[model samples]
Target: MALVHHDPQDGILITRIGQAEITVRPEPPASASGAPVILLRVDAPMLDTLAAAYLDPDEARRLAQALVHAAEAVRPATPWRSPRPNTR
Candidate 1:
């Protein structure tokens, strides 16, 4: 069986995966209240996006905030920095 999933609720988190991908799809129409479509895709194991969520903008924002807060709580003291672009 494949390892890891977009969210812990969806699959078991047994292995230590080094990579993941999160993508935000195009939003639904402003007035389309009933149209709750999948807005985010979380792909673990780095190869496929097998998990998704149909969250509205507000819900997405709240989830993002929670994730950031929890991440900060357990994050290493040394901040993670983006690599500088190579200049040739």
Candidate 2:
């Protein structure tokens, strides 16, 4: 599980994944609408691996889109519910 923390003092968002923790500062207001301002801090090794895995930008985008679709498909629609009794 990942932990997310919002700091009002610094206006920074911190996300802790496993043992790794990263802080991102949001961009100043007045940019494009609904654009993500914060940037995630990733180590060089991890960045290199990610780059190598998807050498082509187009392929990477395709893979990411596919992953999102697959993730949505596997997610449960709602909380587990027992089946209703069958009518005669």
Candidate 3:
């Protein structure tokens, strides 16, 4: 990733996601101190298409693992092989 924007008043970025968003903040009344949780949401919305979910740190970790597991389940054991070149 590149430093697209930088400003002392804008604050530093903790991380970035592709077509998705994640924010960590304390729950409930912003004034009151509470356990910090995460808010996961999609970056873009097509025709009001967006998936938003409130998840704790633990749940976030599990979600990551689940994503990996699901991806691996359908992932090919070997990489795709291109067709052989024609000798003719």
Which candidate tops TM-score?
3
Taking the tens digit of each residue's C-alpha lDDT, what string does model 1 give over 6-71? 354532233234676555554455575565443676668657546877786678779879988777
| lDDT of the candidates, in the order given | 0.60, 0.53, 0.55
Better of 1 and 2 by TM-score: 1
lDDT of 2 by residue, 1-88 (tens): 3658887887666666655565555454345654434443533444343211212345546755887767766784567644758998
Q: In candidate 3, how many Å is residue 9 off?
A: 17
Q: How far out, in Å, is residue 49 in model 3?
A: 3.0
Candidate 2: list runs displaced more than 4 Å: 7-12, 29-36, 43-70, 77-88
Which residue segments of model 1 deviate by more than 4 Å? 1-20, 30-38, 44-49, 76-88
lDDT of 3 by residue, 7-62 (tens): 44533233335544433332443346656566665444334466667777799789
Comparing candidate 1 with candidate 3, which one achieves the higher lDDT?
1
In candidate 3, how many Å is residue 17 off?
A: 11
